[model samples]
Target chain A: MQKVFGRPKGLTEIPFHYCPGCTHGIIHRLIGEVLEELNIIEDTIGVAPVGCAGFSLDFFSCDFVGAAHGRAQAVATGIKRALPDRIVFTYQGDGDIAAIGTSHAIHVAARGEKITSIMVNNAIYGMTGGQMAPTTLTGQVTTTSPYGRDNGVAGFPLDLPKAIATFDGAVYVASVSVDSPKNILQAKKAIKKAFRVQQAGLGFALVSILSTCPTNWGMSPVDSLKWLQEKMIPVYQMGEIKVAEEVKGL
Target chain B: MSKVLLKGNEAIAEAAMRAGCKLFFGYPITPSTEIIEYLAKHLPEAGGTVLQAECEVAAINMCFGAAAAGARVMTASSSPGISLKQEGISYLAANELPVVIVNINRTGPGLGGLGPTQSDYFQSTRGGGHGDYRLIVLAPSKAQELYDLTMEAFDLADKYRNPVLILADGFLGQMMEPVLLKEKKEGNLPPKDWQTDGCKGRAKRKIASYFLVNELAEEACQRWQAKYDQIKEAEQRWESFYADDAEYLLVGYGTCGRIAKSVVLNARKQGMKLGLIRPITLWPFPVKAFTSHFDGIKGIVTVELNAGQMIEDVKLAVNCRVPVHLYKRQGGMLPHEREILKFVGQVFNLPVRGEA
Candidate 1:
């Protein structure tokens, strides 16, 4: 008998608390698989932010520190500075990274802290019952913006990866997706490269994953993936936003 | 150990490094920026690291992260900057992470002036941050005590797994005096068995302050309260001078404490029986130390740089046993020794030195 598929060794037996159709499960699996494949699971510290992503403290087998809302980058900066030999990563939601934590995000990249950050952009605040997010599209309707987001009043959706790519300190910046098997595989590759960038002692590395919030989006799990592909892929500008010459070789 | 003339802020930084603190995260602010600058130059050579964070908010969160990893971590800021750090401070308290926070307080109700003021007494002593939590607060009046208390702060923080604050004023931060710094601690201190280094051979551990279950959250709260109770019992620190056979007792802390001491000495020379009770540890309040001297004391005067914050605590300690008067200034004005003596003279109905 051949064993083909099983849970990654980096994940725990505890069941995920994410919504049934949430893409968080897929993204979590990709990260777990990457950790296992890198054989650095035991040497890594994961910082989990306050959101649906905050629950990652329980999901990862590696040591975890839970951060207050939007402060995961600052927390990760501390861990990496203290233990430079160990790998550090932060898992943050769009609201946690792009909204209240905007200053931390910009400065963390500016300071060139040698850590990895994964921004799960579901375009809406999932944990807080679908409030409008900084990444919400202009015409998107949310709990806070029931009449649809007005570009003039609410401002345009932030293109974070593109903005981050301009920072010289951020050596690697990639906007990935997990809408399908192919995109999931691509997301894993980007995540692994980001970790490798840290191992090489390069500057900051960020991988933004376009995730789906099925329950909050009022769509089926299957339809949520479709919405992400049809609606999000056009707006987010997928693929590598920036890669330094040193990082490109990796 | 040899004595060195160092400013209060530099002495604090040096003392922290000598006490085995290896990680310092801070943002630049007046009267306290020297601590960051000193550490940035010296900490890396000592095999530690100093990170200039994006802001005070980020600096404290950085401390939270490093402390969770079982490192001796710290952050220094002034009043306005400390206000920005309150959110992260509350989070650190909730997680029960041991870290040292230094508040070189300046005048503030908003972004007030950069001068010496004890305006942050209530903020520091009354759980400055949100939620129900207490930080071990130490008030040092001089550079020597600043060095000594900074060392003690690290041990106290680790001993109880709680945040310990060194509440100083801008004057204390800027003043220069001889200080005997401890030798750098060799090898490692006790193992932080609870640190989230890695779960290589053991079950995964999480350093988190959140508990969704109601009973679990209540248990966590009880745990923090129990620790605070133990600290309050074992860690009350104060100094009483001329308190024996004295009819009047003057109470103060930090810069005001030092000023009050001179007033007591001047009053005594003029044949007015006066004593001074200085609280070294502000959080524990030194209530027992102050109340014990109330037997024959006719009145107690609390001198402060704030309007009347510490007077409330003094009254509570005295429990109406004697009159508690407030001699105070605000907005960065230092209460002079002469002015304090005049106020004490008025409180006791004594003959004034200048009165004909």
Candidate 2:
């Protein structure tokens, strides 16, 4: 009998505090595995945003700095600039990256800040009792959108990966999903490549992961995955949306 | 080794470089814009990074990251821009990161004017951001003091593992004066054992301000309060000019203090018993400066460029031992020396002085 699988060295011994049926745990595990696989765990610094994503500070076995809401990109830019040899990344949620932090997100990409960003898109504000987020579907019902999100007043959901892919500084941009086993593996691959982009000193790389928030969506673990597959995958353009010639070599 | 003429903002930037500052992130704002301009021109040549952030908010957050990565970092702005940085400043305070923030204040409740004013005294001393924390505020009244105190701010920040603010007004920021450049001395600072550069050969480090448990948050607050208490005890700084055996005392800080000193000199020449107490550390308020000079002190007057903000601290320091008077000019107006002399003469019921 041999050990087929176990916890990755990139993760700490503490268990995650994510709610059951939530996809954040899976995303964290994928990042952990990527860090271990790259062998850059010790050379990496991570910035955590102010949401459920902020809890990743305790989960990752790397140097971490927690940033104010939506400021993760700016913070990561600082760390990357100060210690250019060290790899830096930011873990932000849709609400944190696409809403209040929109300015930093756009400018960080425009500056080509040679860092990786993992945007976890769960459609709604997970930690804040399911408020309407910028990534929420137009007709989706959230706590703040009691009557369902209306494009007239609240605006439609933002396709951020497509938007980011247009920037010249963004050398690699991928939209991923984790609803199924096959998709999970693809998400991990995209995440690893994103980190490799940073290792190669390429421009900014981002992997936008469409995650599930079962508690906020009022669905079971199984049902939330189904909902994400049926609703989010079609709306957000999936797979490598943009890849620069330099990133193709990686 | 030699004295050179420099603007206050430029001198502060040069001094920060001498103090081992390796990164500067700032946004250009009136009066304080020269700081970022000077750094952008010189810092890169000195093997440092000077970034102009998207906004003041982003600049301060960049400082947060650089400081957490164990780099000596600084960011500067004026009143409006400083207000935009309040959120990041609060996070820096809670995380106990050592960074330098310079606020070259202009008149403002909101975009009032670019003229020199000390209206930001309450904002600086009372913790402009949210949370139960305090920033060590250093007030420099001259270009020379700007250079000296900017270097001192980095040491104070590193020593206490806290943010230090250099609070000056536009008057000092734009004014040119001769500054004697001193050789950088090695400060006995504690090792940055907790920086987040890398985890190689050591345990992983996390720099954060969030405490999920209520009791843990309270404990963090207690720790911060203890640190602030120690700072208040050891860091109270002030300069006294002719305060001894004077019947009238004038209190001020920054540019107002510089002007008040001249008022003291002119009043003394007229045989009027006058003195000046200029606080170098505005947060600590220099309460000890008032403990001894109360034998014949009839009145204490605070000369300010704002509407009597520091007078509150002056009143607290005096403990009502004598009446505290306020002679202020708001909306970017400077309190002229002659007008102050007239106000003092009226308040104390003394004879009119020369040139008034």
Best by DockQ: 2
Cα deviation at A158, candidate 1, in Å, is 0.7
TM-score, B chain alone, candidates in order: 0.96, 0.98
**Tens-digit lDDT track for model 2 on B153-269?**
999999999999999988899999999998677878999998999899999999998888999999999999999999989999999999998899999889989889889988988
User: Judged by lDDT, which candidate is best?
Assistant: 2
Query: Which residue pairs of candidate 2 clash?
Result: none
Minimum summed lDDT over a 10-residue window in model 1 chain B is located at: B182-191
Segments in model 2 whose C-alpha atoms lie over 4 Å from true places: B354-356
State the fraction of real interface contacts model 1 keeps: 0.77
Lowest-lDDT window of 10 residues in candidate 2 chain A? Answer: A102-111
- Relative to the true structure, candidate 1 reaches a TM of 0.98
Clashes of 2: 0
Q: What tens-digit string does per-residue lDDT give for candidate 2 at A1-250? A: 9999999988999999999988999999999999999999999999999998778999999999999999999999889888999999999999999999989888888889999999999999998899999999978999999899999999999988888888999999999999999999999999999999999998999999999999999999999999999988888999999999989988
* Distance from true location, Cα of B192 in model 2, Å: 0.8
